[model samples]
Target chain A: MIAENVAFGIIAAAMALGALGVVRTKNVVHAALYLVVVLAGGAAQFILLGQEFVAWVQVLVYIGAVIVLFLFGIMLTRAPMHPKDSLDNDLRWPAAVTALFLVGILVGLLVHTFHADKIHLNGPVRTADITNDIFTTYIIPFEVVGVLLLGALIGAVVLARKD
Target chain B: MLLNEFLILAAFLFCTGVYGVLARKHAVLVLMSVELMLAGVNINFVAFGAFHNDRIGQVFALFVLTIAAAEVGIGLAIVLLIYRNLHSADLDDVDTMKG
Candidate 1:
Protein backbone atom coordinates (compact mmCIF):
# COMPACT_ATOMS: atom_id res chain seq x y z
CA MET A 1 0.00 0.00 0.00
CA ILE A 2 1.06 3.57 -0.64
CA ALA A 3 0.50 4.33 3.03
CA GLU A 4 2.93 1.68 4.23
CA ASN A 5 5.64 2.85 1.83
CA VAL A 6 5.21 6.46 2.85
CA ALA A 7 5.31 5.65 6.54
CA PHE A 8 8.28 3.39 6.14
CA GLY A 9 10.08 5.92 4.04
CA ILE A 10 9.53 8.68 6.56
CA ILE A 11 10.59 6.64 9.56
CA ALA A 12 13.61 5.18 7.77
CA ALA A 13 14.71 8.64 6.70
CA ALA A 14 14.39 9.93 10.26
CA MET A 15 16.41 7.01 11.64
CA ALA A 16 19.18 7.43 9.09
CA LEU A 17 19.42 11.15 9.62
CA GLY A 18 19.43 10.70 13.37
CA ALA A 19 22.19 8.14 12.95
CA LEU A 20 24.22 10.64 11.00
CA GLY A 21 23.79 13.11 13.82
CA VAL A 22 24.94 10.52 16.32
CA VAL A 23 28.16 9.88 14.41
CA ARG A 24 28.92 13.33 13.18
CA THR A 25 28.45 15.24 16.39
CA LYS A 26 31.60 16.07 18.25
CA ASN A 27 30.05 16.69 21.64
CA VAL A 28 29.53 13.55 23.67
CA VAL A 29 26.43 14.92 25.36
CA HIS A 30 25.04 15.96 22.02
CA ALA A 31 25.78 12.52 20.67
CA ALA A 32 23.93 10.98 23.57
CA LEU A 33 20.98 13.24 22.92
CA TYR A 34 21.02 12.42 19.23
CA LEU A 35 20.90 8.77 20.21
CA VAL A 36 17.53 9.53 21.76
CA VAL A 37 16.35 10.73 18.40
CA VAL A 38 17.69 7.64 16.70
CA LEU A 39 16.06 5.35 19.23
CA ALA A 40 12.75 7.16 18.93
CA GLY A 41 12.90 6.97 15.17
CA GLY A 42 13.63 3.27 15.35
CA ALA A 43 10.69 2.89 17.70
CA ALA A 44 8.43 4.60 15.20
CA GLN A 45 9.70 2.28 12.50
CA PHE A 46 8.96 -0.73 14.70
CA ILE A 47 5.42 0.47 15.35
CA LEU A 48 4.77 0.88 11.64
CA LEU A 49 5.89 -2.73 11.24
CA GLY A 50 2.93 -3.64 13.49
CA GLN A 51 4.94 -4.41 16.61
CA GLU A 52 3.32 -1.97 18.97
CA PHE A 53 4.69 -3.64 22.08
CA VAL A 54 8.22 -3.63 20.77
CA ALA A 55 7.87 0.01 19.85
CA TRP A 56 6.77 0.85 23.37
CA VAL A 57 9.68 -1.09 24.83
CA GLN A 58 12.06 0.73 22.53
CA VAL A 59 10.77 4.07 23.71
CA LEU A 60 10.40 3.15 27.36
CA VAL A 61 13.67 1.32 27.83
CA TYR A 62 16.03 3.27 25.60
CA ILE A 63 14.63 6.73 26.10
CA GLY A 64 13.38 6.34 29.62
CA ALA A 65 16.12 4.33 31.31
CA VAL A 66 19.27 4.02 29.24
CA ILE A 67 19.46 7.64 28.17
CA VAL A 68 18.69 8.87 31.67
CA LEU A 69 21.62 6.86 33.03
CA PHE A 70 23.75 8.11 30.18
CA LEU A 71 22.97 11.69 31.12
CA PHE A 72 23.51 10.98 34.79
CA GLY A 73 26.90 9.53 34.05
CA ILE A 74 27.71 12.63 32.08
CA MET A 75 26.83 14.82 35.00
CA LEU A 76 28.54 12.66 37.62
CA THR A 77 31.74 12.69 35.64
CA ARG A 78 31.47 16.35 34.73
CA ALA A 79 31.88 14.97 31.25
CA PRO A 80 32.87 17.63 28.78
CA MET A 81 29.92 19.36 27.18
CA HIS A 82 31.92 19.45 23.94
CA PRO A 83 33.86 16.79 22.06
CA LYS A 84 37.14 18.69 22.33
CA ASP A 85 37.89 17.20 25.73
CA SER A 86 40.56 14.87 24.30
CA LEU A 87 41.59 12.37 21.67
CA ASP A 88 41.23 14.58 18.63
CA ASN A 89 43.31 12.07 16.72
CA ASP A 90 41.59 11.07 13.55
CA LEU A 91 41.54 7.72 11.76
CA ARG A 92 43.28 7.35 8.47
CA TRP A 93 40.78 7.72 5.65
CA PRO A 94 42.10 4.63 3.91
CA ALA A 95 41.30 2.51 6.91
CA ALA A 96 37.89 4.07 7.18
CA VAL A 97 37.30 3.46 3.48
CA THR A 98 38.34 -0.17 3.70
CA ALA A 99 36.13 -0.85 6.67
CA LEU A 100 33.23 0.73 4.84
CA PHE A 101 34.00 -1.44 1.83
CA LEU A 102 33.89 -4.58 3.93
CA VAL A 103 30.63 -3.48 5.52
CA GLY A 104 29.11 -2.92 2.10
CA ILE A 105 30.28 -6.32 0.90
CA LEU A 106 28.87 -8.01 3.96
CA VAL A 107 25.54 -6.25 3.53
CA GLY A 108 25.36 -7.33 -0.07
CA LEU A 109 26.13 -10.91 0.88
CA LEU A 110 23.49 -10.92 3.61
CA VAL A 111 20.87 -9.43 1.31
CA HIS A 112 21.57 -12.08 -1.27
CA THR A 113 21.38 -14.81 1.32
CA PHE A 114 18.12 -13.67 2.94
CA HIS A 115 16.56 -12.89 -0.41
CA ALA A 116 12.77 -13.20 -0.76
CA ASP A 117 12.71 -16.44 -2.70
CA LYS A 118 14.85 -18.05 -0.04
CA ILE A 119 12.59 -17.09 2.85
CA HIS A 120 9.22 -18.81 3.39
CA LEU A 121 7.47 -15.58 4.18
CA ASN A 122 4.55 -15.31 6.56
CA GLY A 123 2.23 -12.47 7.41
CA PRO A 124 2.67 -10.11 10.32
CA VAL A 125 2.18 -11.94 13.58
CA ARG A 126 -0.95 -10.44 15.06
CA THR A 127 -1.08 -9.29 18.67
CA ALA A 128 -3.07 -12.34 19.81
CA ASP A 129 -0.61 -14.68 18.14
CA ILE A 130 2.38 -13.03 19.82
CA THR A 131 0.54 -13.08 23.13
CA ASN A 132 -0.01 -16.78 22.78
CA ASP A 133 3.66 -17.38 22.01
CA ILE A 134 4.79 -15.21 24.91
CA PHE A 135 2.63 -17.00 27.45
CA THR A 136 3.08 -20.54 26.14
CA THR A 137 6.26 -21.32 24.27
CA TYR A 138 8.43 -18.49 25.61
CA ILE A 139 7.39 -18.56 29.23
CA ILE A 140 10.73 -20.00 30.31
CA PRO A 141 12.91 -17.45 28.55
CA PHE A 142 10.63 -14.71 29.71
CA GLU A 143 11.18 -15.69 33.32
CA VAL A 144 14.88 -16.25 32.78
CA VAL A 145 15.29 -12.73 31.47
CA GLY A 146 14.12 -11.49 34.84
CA VAL A 147 17.03 -13.28 36.46
CA LEU A 148 19.37 -11.68 33.97
CA LEU A 149 17.99 -8.25 34.79
CA LEU A 150 18.45 -8.90 38.48
CA GLY A 151 22.08 -9.73 37.90
CA ALA A 152 22.55 -6.54 35.95
CA LEU A 153 20.99 -4.50 38.72
CA ILE A 154 23.30 -5.99 41.30
CA GLY A 155 26.29 -5.47 39.07
CA ALA A 156 25.37 -1.85 38.50
CA VAL A 157 24.95 -1.19 42.22
CA VAL A 158 28.24 -2.86 43.03
CA LEU A 159 30.03 -0.92 40.35
CA ALA A 160 28.59 2.38 41.46
CA ARG A 161 29.20 1.94 45.14
CA LYS A 162 32.10 4.17 46.08
CA ASP A 163 34.81 2.85 48.33
CA MET B 1 8.63 -6.04 2.32
CA LEU B 2 10.38 -9.36 2.96
CA LEU B 3 13.08 -10.43 5.37
CA ASN B 4 15.75 -8.87 3.20
CA GLU B 5 14.54 -5.31 3.84
CA PHE B 6 14.81 -5.81 7.54
CA LEU B 7 18.15 -7.50 7.10
CA ILE B 8 19.38 -4.64 4.98
CA LEU B 9 18.14 -2.07 7.45
CA ALA B 10 19.75 -3.90 10.33
CA ALA B 11 22.96 -4.21 8.36
CA PHE B 12 22.92 -0.55 7.54
CA LEU B 13 22.36 0.35 11.17
CA PHE B 14 25.01 -2.10 12.34
CA CYS B 15 27.53 -0.79 9.86
CA THR B 16 26.79 2.78 10.80
CA GLY B 17 27.21 1.88 14.44
CA VAL B 18 30.44 0.07 13.69
CA TYR B 19 31.76 3.05 11.86
CA GLY B 20 30.83 5.28 14.77
CA VAL B 21 32.50 2.88 17.21
CA LEU B 22 35.63 2.74 15.13
CA ALA B 23 35.75 6.44 14.50
CA ARG B 24 34.83 7.94 17.87
CA LYS B 25 37.27 8.62 20.69
CA HIS B 26 35.07 9.54 23.62
CA ALA B 27 33.97 6.71 25.85
CA VAL B 28 30.32 7.72 26.17
CA LEU B 29 29.98 8.09 22.42
CA VAL B 30 31.33 4.61 21.99
CA LEU B 31 28.66 3.26 24.29
CA MET B 32 25.98 5.07 22.32
CA SER B 33 27.33 3.56 19.13
CA VAL B 34 27.15 0.08 20.61
CA GLU B 35 23.54 0.64 21.66
CA LEU B 36 22.69 1.73 18.15
CA MET B 37 24.05 -1.51 16.80
CA LEU B 38 22.12 -3.58 19.32
CA ALA B 39 18.87 -1.82 18.42
CA GLY B 40 19.46 -2.55 14.78
CA VAL B 41 19.87 -6.23 15.55
CA ASN B 42 16.74 -6.16 17.67
CA ILE B 43 14.72 -4.83 14.73
CA ASN B 44 16.03 -7.64 12.56
CA PHE B 45 14.99 -10.22 15.11
CA VAL B 46 11.44 -8.89 15.41
CA ALA B 47 11.10 -8.62 11.68
CA PHE B 48 12.25 -12.17 11.13
CA GLY B 49 9.87 -13.44 13.77
CA ALA B 50 6.94 -11.71 12.11
CA PHE B 51 7.84 -13.22 8.76
CA HIS B 52 8.45 -16.78 10.00
CA ASN B 53 5.24 -17.36 11.94
CA ASP B 54 7.43 -17.80 15.01
CA ARG B 55 7.61 -15.77 18.15
CA ILE B 56 11.29 -16.52 18.57
CA GLY B 57 12.32 -13.13 17.20
CA GLN B 58 10.25 -11.34 19.80
CA VAL B 59 11.76 -13.50 22.51
CA PHE B 60 15.21 -12.82 21.18
CA ALA B 61 14.42 -9.13 21.17
CA LEU B 62 13.26 -9.34 24.77
CA PHE B 63 16.52 -11.00 25.70
CA VAL B 64 18.45 -8.34 23.82
CA LEU B 65 16.46 -5.65 25.60
CA THR B 66 17.52 -7.11 28.91
CA ILE B 67 21.14 -7.19 27.86
CA ALA B 68 21.07 -3.66 26.53
CA ALA B 69 19.53 -2.32 29.72
CA ALA B 70 22.18 -4.06 31.79
CA GLU B 71 24.87 -2.92 29.46
CA VAL B 72 23.88 0.72 29.85
CA GLY B 73 23.58 0.38 33.58
CA ILE B 74 27.00 -1.17 33.97
CA GLY B 75 28.51 1.07 31.37
CA LEU B 76 27.34 4.25 33.08
CA ALA B 77 28.42 2.94 36.44
CA ILE B 78 31.86 2.24 35.07
CA VAL B 79 31.90 5.64 33.51
CA LEU B 80 31.23 7.15 36.87
CA LEU B 81 33.88 4.97 38.45
CA ILE B 82 36.37 5.93 35.80
CA TYR B 83 35.63 9.60 36.23
CA ARG B 84 36.14 9.25 39.95
CA ASN B 85 39.58 7.80 39.34
CA LEU B 86 40.78 9.66 36.23
CA HIS B 87 38.78 12.93 36.21
CA SER B 88 38.28 12.51 32.48
CA ALA B 89 36.14 10.32 30.21
CA ASP B 90 38.60 10.53 27.38
CA LEU B 91 39.76 7.18 26.03
CA ASP B 92 43.17 8.66 25.33
CA ASP B 93 43.58 9.48 29.01
CA VAL B 94 42.70 5.91 29.93
CA ASP B 95 46.22 4.65 29.38
CA THR B 96 46.76 3.34 32.91
CA MET B 97 44.78 0.20 32.08
CA LYS B 98 46.47 -0.20 28.70
CA GLY B 99 50.11 -0.61 29.57
Candidate 2:
Protein backbone atom coordinates (compact mmCIF):
# COMPACT_ATOMS: atom_id res chain seq x y z
CA MET A 1 0.00 0.00 0.00
CA ILE A 2 2.79 2.39 0.92
CA ALA A 3 4.72 1.54 -2.23
CA GLU A 4 1.69 2.08 -4.40
CA ASN A 5 1.04 5.46 -2.84
CA VAL A 6 4.63 6.51 -3.31
CA ALA A 7 4.68 5.39 -6.91
CA PHE A 8 1.47 7.21 -7.60
CA GLY A 9 2.77 10.38 -6.03
CA ILE A 10 5.97 10.31 -8.05
CA ILE A 11 4.28 9.56 -11.36
CA ALA A 12 1.63 12.16 -10.77
CA ALA A 13 4.20 14.82 -10.01
CA ALA A 14 6.15 13.94 -13.14
CA MET A 15 3.02 14.09 -15.24
CA ALA A 16 2.05 17.52 -13.91
CA LEU A 17 5.53 18.92 -14.34
CA GLY A 18 5.89 17.48 -17.81
CA ALA A 19 2.55 18.89 -18.80
CA LEU A 20 3.60 22.28 -17.52
CA GLY A 21 6.76 22.06 -19.58
CA VAL A 22 4.79 21.12 -22.67
CA VAL A 23 2.76 24.32 -22.57
CA ARG A 24 5.21 26.70 -20.95
CA THR A 25 8.21 25.99 -23.14
CA LYS A 26 8.91 28.41 -25.96
CA ASN A 27 10.72 25.97 -28.23
CA VAL A 28 8.54 23.54 -30.14
CA VAL A 29 10.95 20.57 -30.03
CA HIS A 30 11.37 21.02 -26.30
CA ALA A 31 7.60 20.97 -25.99
CA ALA A 32 7.54 17.67 -27.86
CA LEU A 33 10.16 16.21 -25.52
CA TYR A 34 8.15 17.37 -22.53
CA LEU A 35 5.12 15.73 -24.07
CA VAL A 36 7.09 12.47 -24.18
CA VAL A 37 7.72 12.77 -20.46
CA VAL A 38 4.06 13.47 -19.83
CA LEU A 39 2.97 10.48 -21.95
CA ALA A 40 5.47 8.16 -20.24
CA GLY A 41 4.16 9.31 -16.89
CA GLY A 42 0.66 8.46 -18.07
CA ALA A 43 1.82 4.94 -18.91
CA ALA A 44 3.24 4.67 -15.43
CA GLN A 45 -0.09 5.71 -14.01
CA PHE A 46 -1.76 2.90 -15.95
CA ILE A 47 0.73 0.43 -14.50
CA LEU A 48 0.02 1.69 -11.01
CA LEU A 49 -3.64 0.95 -11.70
CA GLY A 50 -2.57 -2.65 -12.49
CA GLN A 51 -3.43 -2.26 -16.15
CA GLU A 52 -0.16 -3.55 -17.56
CA PHE A 53 -1.46 -4.19 -21.05
CA VAL A 54 -2.82 -0.69 -21.38
CA ALA A 55 0.38 0.73 -19.93
CA TRP A 56 2.55 -0.95 -22.52
CA VAL A 57 0.17 -0.03 -25.28
CA GLN A 58 0.21 3.57 -24.10
CA VAL A 59 3.98 3.65 -24.20
CA LEU A 60 4.25 1.85 -27.53
CA VAL A 61 1.61 3.81 -29.37
CA TYR A 62 2.09 7.24 -27.79
CA ILE A 63 5.80 7.54 -27.17
CA GLY A 64 6.77 5.35 -30.10
CA ALA A 65 4.49 6.50 -32.88
CA VAL A 66 2.67 9.69 -31.93
CA ILE A 67 5.64 11.64 -30.62
CA VAL A 68 7.63 10.60 -33.66
CA LEU A 69 4.86 11.88 -35.87
CA PHE A 70 4.88 15.20 -33.99
CA LEU A 71 8.65 15.46 -34.43
CA PHE A 72 8.33 14.80 -38.12
CA GLY A 73 5.70 17.49 -38.43
CA ILE A 74 7.83 19.91 -36.45
CA MET A 75 10.85 19.17 -38.61
CA LEU A 76 8.98 19.28 -41.88
CA THR A 77 7.32 22.54 -40.91
CA ARG A 78 10.65 24.03 -39.83
CA ALA A 79 9.81 25.04 -36.29
CA PRO A 80 12.35 27.38 -34.79
CA MET A 81 14.74 26.00 -32.17
CA HIS A 82 15.17 29.31 -30.43
CA PRO A 83 12.54 30.78 -28.18
CA LYS A 84 10.17 32.94 -30.18
CA ASP A 85 7.51 35.42 -29.12
CA SER A 86 5.23 34.28 -31.90
CA LEU A 87 4.61 30.84 -30.37
CA ASP A 88 1.91 32.28 -28.17
CA ASN A 89 -0.89 34.61 -29.12
CA ASP A 90 -2.21 37.74 -27.40
CA LEU A 91 -4.93 35.73 -25.66
CA ARG A 92 -2.49 34.12 -23.24
CA TRP A 93 -4.05 35.73 -20.20
CA PRO A 94 -7.58 34.84 -21.22
CA ALA A 95 -6.55 31.29 -22.05
CA ALA A 96 -4.85 30.95 -18.69
CA VAL A 97 -8.01 32.10 -16.93
CA THR A 98 -10.13 29.66 -18.90
CA ALA A 99 -7.75 26.81 -18.14
CA LEU A 100 -7.85 27.57 -14.46
CA PHE A 101 -11.62 27.71 -14.51
CA LEU A 102 -11.79 24.35 -16.25
CA VAL A 103 -9.41 22.80 -13.77
CA GLY A 104 -11.41 24.17 -10.88
CA ILE A 105 -14.68 22.77 -12.19
CA LEU A 106 -13.32 19.35 -13.03
CA VAL A 107 -11.41 18.94 -9.79
CA GLY A 108 -14.37 20.10 -7.74
CA LEU A 109 -16.71 17.72 -9.50
CA LEU A 110 -14.34 14.79 -9.11
CA VAL A 111 -13.74 15.44 -5.46
CA HIS A 112 -17.41 15.78 -4.70
CA THR A 113 -18.30 12.65 -6.67
CA PHE A 114 -15.54 10.21 -5.75
CA HIS A 115 -13.59 11.57 -2.84
CA ALA A 116 -14.20 8.50 -0.72
CA ASP A 117 -13.89 5.91 -3.44
CA LYS A 118 -10.91 3.59 -3.34
CA ILE A 119 -9.61 1.58 -6.26
CA HIS A 120 -8.48 -1.99 -5.77
CA LEU A 121 -5.20 -2.82 -7.41
CA ASN A 122 -5.83 -6.56 -7.26
CA GLY A 123 -7.60 -8.55 -10.00
CA PRO A 124 -5.50 -7.19 -12.81
CA VAL A 125 -7.22 -7.62 -16.15
CA ARG A 126 -5.28 -9.96 -18.35
CA THR A 127 -4.46 -9.12 -21.94
CA ALA A 128 -6.20 -12.29 -23.06
CA ASP A 129 -9.40 -11.26 -21.34
CA ILE A 130 -9.23 -7.85 -22.98
CA THR A 131 -8.60 -9.46 -26.37
CA ASN A 132 -11.47 -11.90 -25.86
CA ASP A 133 -13.84 -9.13 -24.90
CA ILE A 134 -12.65 -6.98 -27.77
CA PHE A 135 -13.23 -9.77 -30.23
CA THR A 136 -16.56 -10.80 -28.77
CA THR A 137 -18.54 -7.88 -27.42
CA TYR A 138 -16.69 -4.94 -28.92
CA ILE A 139 -16.03 -6.45 -32.29
CA ILE A 140 -17.81 -3.86 -34.38
CA PRO A 141 -16.05 -0.90 -32.80
CA PHE A 142 -12.79 -2.78 -33.15
CA GLU A 143 -13.39 -3.26 -36.86
CA VAL A 144 -14.40 0.38 -37.18
CA VAL A 145 -11.13 1.49 -35.58
CA GLY A 146 -9.22 -0.60 -38.10
CA VAL A 147 -11.09 1.04 -40.94
CA LEU A 148 -10.40 4.44 -39.39
CA LEU A 149 -6.71 3.73 -39.31
CA LEU A 150 -6.73 2.70 -42.95
CA GLY A 151 -8.56 5.84 -43.94
CA ALA A 152 -6.17 8.00 -41.92
CA LEU A 153 -3.21 6.38 -43.59
CA ILE A 154 -4.53 6.96 -47.08
CA GLY A 155 -5.59 10.49 -46.26
CA ALA A 156 -2.22 11.36 -44.76
CA VAL A 157 -0.35 10.01 -47.77
CA VAL A 158 -2.58 11.80 -50.22
CA LEU A 159 -2.37 15.10 -48.36
CA ALA A 160 1.36 14.93 -47.66
CA ARG A 161 2.66 13.54 -50.93
CA LYS A 162 4.20 15.99 -53.38
CA ASP A 163 2.69 16.42 -56.82
CA MET B 1 -4.58 6.08 -4.17
CA LEU B 2 -7.97 7.66 -4.07
CA LEU B 3 -10.10 7.91 -7.21
CA ASN B 4 -10.32 11.66 -6.87
CA GLU B 5 -6.55 11.92 -6.90
CA PHE B 6 -6.35 10.41 -10.35
CA LEU B 7 -9.28 12.46 -11.49
CA ILE B 8 -7.70 15.65 -10.27
CA LEU B 9 -4.44 14.81 -11.98
CA ALA B 10 -6.27 14.19 -15.21
CA ALA B 11 -8.02 17.50 -14.78
CA PHE B 12 -4.74 19.30 -14.38
CA LEU B 13 -3.41 17.76 -17.56
CA PHE B 14 -6.57 18.52 -19.42
CA CYS B 15 -6.57 22.13 -18.34
CA THR B 16 -2.96 22.54 -19.38
CA GLY B 17 -3.81 21.14 -22.77
CA VAL B 18 -6.70 23.53 -23.04
CA TYR B 19 -4.46 26.46 -22.29
CA GLY B 20 -1.95 25.21 -24.83
CA VAL B 21 -4.57 24.95 -27.53
CA LEU B 22 -5.94 28.40 -26.89
CA ALA B 23 -2.63 30.20 -26.48
CA ARG B 24 -0.25 28.50 -28.87
CA LYS B 25 0.02 30.11 -32.29
CA HIS B 26 1.63 27.17 -34.07
CA ALA B 27 -0.74 24.62 -35.53
CA VAL B 28 1.56 21.71 -34.60
CA LEU B 29 1.61 22.89 -31.01
CA VAL B 30 -2.15 22.98 -31.06
CA LEU B 31 -2.20 19.39 -32.29
CA MET B 32 0.16 18.36 -29.51
CA SER B 33 -2.13 20.05 -27.00
CA VAL B 34 -5.03 17.99 -28.33
CA GLU B 35 -2.96 14.87 -27.75
CA LEU B 36 -2.41 16.00 -24.16
CA MET B 37 -6.15 16.38 -23.66
CA LEU B 38 -6.73 12.89 -25.04
CA ALA B 39 -4.11 11.54 -22.66
CA GLY B 40 -5.96 13.07 -19.75
CA VAL B 41 -9.19 11.44 -20.88
CA ASN B 42 -7.38 8.12 -21.20
CA ILE B 43 -6.30 8.42 -17.56
CA ASN B 44 -9.88 9.01 -16.52
CA PHE B 45 -11.04 5.96 -18.44
CA VAL B 46 -8.40 3.70 -16.90
CA ALA B 47 -9.08 5.02 -13.42
CA PHE B 48 -12.82 4.43 -13.71
CA GLY B 49 -12.24 0.97 -15.14
CA ALA B 50 -10.00 0.01 -12.27
CA PHE B 51 -12.40 1.48 -9.74
CA HIS B 52 -15.29 -0.55 -11.08
CA ASN B 53 -13.31 -3.73 -11.69
CA ASP B 54 -14.55 -3.70 -15.26
CA ARG B 55 -12.55 -4.26 -18.43
CA ILE B 56 -14.78 -2.05 -20.54
CA GLY B 57 -13.04 1.19 -19.58
CA GLN B 58 -9.71 -0.15 -20.67
CA VAL B 59 -11.23 -1.36 -23.91
CA PHE B 60 -12.66 2.07 -24.53
CA ALA B 61 -9.24 3.47 -23.78
CA LEU B 62 -7.77 1.26 -26.48
CA PHE B 63 -10.28 2.58 -28.96
CA VAL B 64 -9.39 6.12 -27.89
CA LEU B 65 -5.74 5.34 -28.43
CA THR B 66 -6.44 4.09 -31.94
CA ILE B 67 -8.43 7.14 -32.81
CA ALA B 68 -5.76 9.42 -31.35
CA ALA B 69 -3.12 7.76 -33.54
CA ALA B 70 -5.23 8.30 -36.62
CA GLU B 71 -5.92 11.88 -35.56
CA VAL B 72 -2.24 12.68 -35.19
CA GLY B 73 -1.46 11.14 -38.54
CA ILE B 74 -4.08 13.02 -40.50
CA GLY B 75 -3.62 16.17 -38.46
CA LEU B 76 0.10 16.28 -39.13
CA ALA B 77 -0.48 15.69 -42.78
CA ILE B 78 -2.85 18.63 -42.85
CA VAL B 79 -0.34 20.75 -40.93
CA LEU B 80 2.27 19.78 -43.50
CA LEU B 81 -0.01 20.88 -46.29
CA ILE B 82 -0.65 24.19 -44.58
CA TYR B 83 3.06 24.78 -44.07
CA ARG B 84 3.77 24.02 -47.72
CA ASN B 85 1.20 26.48 -48.90
CA LEU B 86 1.80 29.32 -46.48
CA HIS B 87 5.49 28.75 -45.68
CA SER B 88 4.48 29.01 -42.04
CA ALA B 89 2.83 26.92 -39.33
CA ASP B 90 1.44 29.91 -37.48
CA LEU B 91 -2.33 29.66 -37.17
CA ASP B 92 -2.69 33.42 -37.54
CA ASP B 93 -0.91 33.45 -40.88
CA VAL B 94 -3.22 30.86 -42.46
CA ASP B 95 -5.93 33.50 -42.80
CA THR B 96 -6.17 33.52 -46.58
CA MET B 97 -9.58 31.92 -46.30
CA LYS B 98 -10.82 34.78 -44.15
CA GLY B 99 -12.84 37.50 -45.85
Summarize candidate 2's per-residue lDDT along A68-158 as a digit string, tens digits: 9999999999999895566899989999999999999988888888879989777668999999999999999999999999999999999
Write the residue-wise lDDT of candidate 1 on A8-87 in tens digits. 77777778787777877767688788888878877776666667677788788889989998888777877676544443
All candidates' TM-scores? Answer: 0.88, 0.98
Per-residue CA lDDT of model 1 for B1-99, tens digit only, reads: 556766777777787787777777777777888998998899888777667756777767867988899888888888778777888777667887584
| Consecutive 10-residue window with the lowest summed lDDT within model 1 chain B | B1-10
Clashing pairs in 2: none
How many backbone overlaps does candidate 1 show?
A: 0
